[model samples]
Target: MTWLITGGAGYIGAHVVRAMTGAGERTVVYDDLSTGDAGRVPREVPLVVGSVLDGGRLARAIAAHQVTGVVHLAAKKQVGESVGRPLHYYHENVEGLRVLLEAVTAAPVTAFVFSSSAAVYGMPDVDVVTEETPCRPLSPYGETKLAGEWLVRAAGRAAGLATASLRYFNVAGAATPALADTGVSNLVPMVFHRLTEGTAPRVFGDDYPTADGTCVRDYIHVVDLAEAHVTVARALRSTPGLDLTLNVGRGEGVSVREMIDRINAVTGYDHPPTIAPRRPGDPARVVASADRIATELGWRAAHDVQDMITSAWEGWVRLHPAAARA
Candidate 1:
């Protein structure tokens, strides 16, 4: 019942490893440390340093660990960066998954859980997006994730492997400050970085049709999202040949301006946000239904927006002591 968690040293991936291991599951972390901190991986767990693009390494690790399942979390995941470098994203994300799948199918592994994203439903016009929603990814990063889902499902079907793709919404917060996300790629961290620099957090736009006239999204705590991975991993093992694709979110929409206000309140910063032009591919609203995951796995998000802001702010301050509360 050993599981291989690719990208297990990164923020989200590290949390997944911790949750899995803490629950008594035998887990091994496979990460290249491209953006991951090796120290994040617990000493008790084995951390394999290698890229997902390397099939030979993947095969060797699979065999050496007698890995029976895989939770593929390794991928380049920045929308703006992906737009600027599509080829790089394709090679590292899509091509890398292809190579990993080839090795996994060839090995004795029977279960797989892919870390997908809400980005797959690019600019989804729906109020609450479900797994059945049409996928029209806007950015190269989102496209790669959508393609990864297709590859995982098809590969599992042909290989007779159980698979689940958890399409995560906006992920934030941490179980602890050390496990918090370091990248400013997402909204929460982006805001945190600006505030820490004593600069006004810029709201992309405020003319959207939402109540607050700002882009609204479903923000999930990284802890809850990580727990969903464990649930999906175990579910895949129990349900043979399962092809599960569920949204991992709280099913509640939070506006960008509202989030900024929350950040100001939580971090003890009263700075106001400045309005700016909307970024291309920005959806007005993209909240997850979250019904399927709850029904299928009996899981739900226990943290709220305040929890996300405060916990994430704690981590930000830990990394940047200059951002201490006033």
Candidate 2:
């Protein structure tokens, strides 16, 4: 059966595509290439250049590809940007998801895997949030993700479609040779860019209650995250029940200072990070209690901080050797 991956040309989506294609699966990529690059997709895979908001086009692509399952990964993701443009976030994330769901309902494609976020938890009082945690999203981005999950759950219940929403936290690291141009929104990549450019990475708020007084986050490697998607797809095919929402993470929190130190150690960058005040809506700490996915799917993250940093550094260096030299 063919699988449709929306936003399949993006960094995380591209990795998912690589994993799916590498395993000999029939996969079709649907990306608008707003922030995604067509060149990032594997040459062999078929791509449908269209927006998720385009229901007619989406339905056509789904039917044409004979897609039986879908992995929805398209959405506006920048936290700060989402705050400034709440309507845009709602439109792209919520409305786009609505359009996709409508198309799926009409087409009878049941199996689905949603790319969710830990942002839905929104600065929870607890450091590690589980699947059962109450959602109290802070930013517009988080709210949109939560709304998307609600839509998925509703659709699954109403239509008996098997769906899994993987709530990811602080996805980092790279999985391909062309990684330096992977975009500048993620922390690790932006930090790597600053270091490579002979500058220190910026550190926001060093006065939180954590050790080292910085925000702590769960930085799961992209490869491990991609593996989780594979597991989700397999489970949907094999399992009977519907509507699963599980946290995808390493189950450990790494402080911002700790990450910077590790990056410095890995890249031999000696410049100290520039300290800055905390931005609004910035949480003191956010970690994942990923035991649900482990117990349910028997999956675990294999890469540690060193592996994440080294692989990311290698990918960056491969793309920009001169930057690595600095």
What's the TM-score of each model vs. the native? 0.98, 0.97
How does candidate 2 score on lDDT? 0.88
Candidate 1: tens digits of C-alpha lDDT, residues 91-187? 9999999999999999999999999999999887788999999999888899999999999999999999999999999999999999988998788
Which parts of model 1 have CA positions greater than 4 angstroms off?
Answer: none
Badly placed stretches (over 4 Å) of model 2 are 179-181
lDDT per residue (tens digit) for residues 1-326 in model 2: 58899999998999899888877778999999998989888888999999999999999999999998899999999888898999999999999999999998788687988999999998888867888888988899999999999999998878778899999988877776674236777888788889888888999899998989999999999889988998889889776456699999998999998999898889888778899888766788889998988998899999888888888888888877886644
* Residue pairs in collision within model 1: none
Which candidate has the top score in lDDT? 1
Judged by TM-score, which candidate is best?
1
